[model samples]
Target: MAESNCTQVTEFTLTGFTDNPVTQVTLFLMFLLIYLVTVLGNLGMILLIKVSPQLHSPMYYFLGNLAFVDLCSSTVITPKMLVDFISKKGIAYAGCMAQVFIYDLFGMTEGFLLATMAYDRYMAVCHPLLYPLVMSPKCCFQLVTGSYLIGLTNGIGQTIGMSTLSFCSSSVIDLFFCDISPLISLSTSDTTLSHVILRTSACLFGVSSSLVILVSYVAIISAILSISSAEGKRKAFSTCTSHLITLSLFYGTVFFVYLKPSSDSSREDKWAAVLYTVVTPMLNPLIYSLRNKEVKEALRRLTKIK
Candidate 1:
């Protein structure tokens, strides 16, 4: 029987947050409402960016792409989570693999895309004279395309690596979705290589992209300081406040959940998952719209037109 289970984990149960009847129903309703807002906010941001002529720039272009990624990521993770909450919660092996691939596809893409946007901002603020030529529409497309391709490659590698492993023991996943870390922890097979590969790849994708964003902000700050007028400096810095806040919120939760020293606590990690997987996507559009004058003005114009 052990050998048979090793050959294939036909189905894996998800030990979602709670099993209490009332608590489960309450959690289900809450998550459903949050998922709806996430969808609407991300989709609305994309639609507004598309229709507003004033937003036809590299910044807005990248924002639309970010919104698309957020929307897809939330959709990929949340609906299935909701289903698991309300019904028998078991996913086939293939289904779990698909979840990991799709979730990482967007998650990694967003990491690199945020770095790309930081670079965009750096060029715009620090190298204004050369920004037009350096960050041309073609370059924007290539950057976004390259980020997606990298994410695709990462997702494929993660899926293939996961498929190679065999699960001979307990097949219960103690998380909301098919997070790679928790899934690997449940594996009975020797996972030394899998752990190394996942850790290396996560660092390569997460830390490297974060480094790029950090360097870009350094340059942006230097440029902002060089400005002669106080208002000019404030204007330059204000544009980045929203992105900075988003970056902090994202990296903070992810680092805590995936990279921190105490990350082995799966019970605590589920609530952290709620943060990045649930809360962040819903807050993104609101953050950008409320913090950005351009987005707010465009939204006003759009409302008046309607």
Candidate 2:
């Protein structure tokens, strides 16, 4: 905890999942493909939402924000990882810190954005008559802005907390990318405060967002079941199924990655990292677009498909 104990390291080597050249190249190609999909998918989602008049709604607005967050988050980590696989030069200290900040920013953004979307669905399914008034344009903008602001505040707190810890001697970080847990585990200086902040933020961002999503859905499900007709119930549930699946995949992977202690890094943690960082980004747009009939119809109109 003392300032004198802080030794400043200039850079950190990334101990990626494997060391074999063949494996490295393979992983490089794999992640390269994934990054490409993430870019195109999220980009297409935003563009389609923008141009399609039929797609303009509170739900789509939140989806656009989610797409942007997924795009940014994947861009922050995957590209650097692919380059590191080939170059093996590792990231500079400032670069690693920036990666940590940007990645977490978008990660937290996606969590809140998903919660926002859940609330959007709740209003649509449970309060259809008042949905338009309650979730007005101004209200929607505020929700999106609030999600980004929350994400920004959390990123700043984590970065400042990390800056206080002095990394010395060992420059090798144990994850594929610069992450909070691995960085803290590799820190040579005192990290009691850093650890406490990390745990608190994880719970704050992860658990709180999850709780909001769960509560929204509880009300949503209750409203759906009260409908008289089977067709009505099916139609009501259909609107939220995509979001529920997205929430499950994103929050499940996040909890697995961050809820536990940092001292407990394993091969499983690395793979779990892959799920959130790589797989989730790529899957989100797919989940929303492929499952939603409205999105499908919008895409058809966008592409001039019959």
Candidate 3:
């Protein structure tokens, strides 16, 4: 295509989940409920961690940050998604890029935070005596800060890469939001740079963070097995169950959606995107609180005070 003939796309129309009016209404109600739970659950978790003296520790500290990331991630996508279900709104080019940047920012940060939580678990389970020294307040702060910094870098790289592409082909996004794959597909210009950036960011954040979690859990499991008493083993392993579940839900959907060979967005990809983006945030707080005795106790204390 000649540069002179290329028409710059000013806005992109988002093709949301369904076209049927009944289905759209049904999905809207369901997603609205999910978003409500997500917001309240994540916000409550953060507040609980902040106000409860009992929850003051490296683990809960990391949990609080995770809740904040989940909140931000869900907020960035769900509100727009809810609006789209009822209305046909066109996202401006700048708005689309902003959405991509913000979504990737929190998404990448969540990956690193999950890994950091795994490391915290390993320290607690494997090196109980040294955990306090190793994962001190300063160290914890640095780790959290590092996660955000890396996430910021990824967001900038991805947005810049997407910005470089000229969307002269079409203005309609197949999926509900402005994602990397969908945007690349819409670009008339060469998408090699965008693909490179996408793959590099995925490998850097996805593989590296997953490796950290894997290594940490390996040592943790080994330490748990070393405990002679059955009760001791159960008690030690119980601490990790919630985190393991949360990790499985998060990474499972993420890997399914992004790590696949074909870049073509499918129905499965759209639903899987919902799992990581909408459902996971709402589930995290419940998983942690219901399984954790300390968190339950903290909640009870909070309720009594109220």
Q: How well does candidate 3 match the true structure in TM-score terms?
A: 0.97
Displacement of the residue 206 alpha carbon in candidate 3, Å? 2.1
Residues 134-219, candidate 3, lDDT per residue (tens digit)? 99999999999999999999999999999999988689997888888888878888889988998898788878999999999999
Model 1 C-alpha lDDT per residue in residues 105-142, reported as the tens digit of each score: 89999999889989999998988899999989999999
Segments of candidate 2 deviating more than 4 angstroms: 1-7, 261-264
lDDT of 1 at 262: 47
Q: Could you tell me every candidate's TM-score relative to the true structure?
A: 0.95, 0.95, 0.97
Candidate 2 overall Cα lDDT vs. reference? 0.88
TM-score-superior candidate, 2 or 3: 3
Per-residue lDDT tens digits of candidate 2, residues 26-66?
98899999999999999999999999999899999999999
lDDT of each: 0.88, 0.88, 0.92
The candidate maximizing TM-score is 3
Identify the leading candidate in terms of lDDT: 3
N/CA/C clash count, model 1: 0
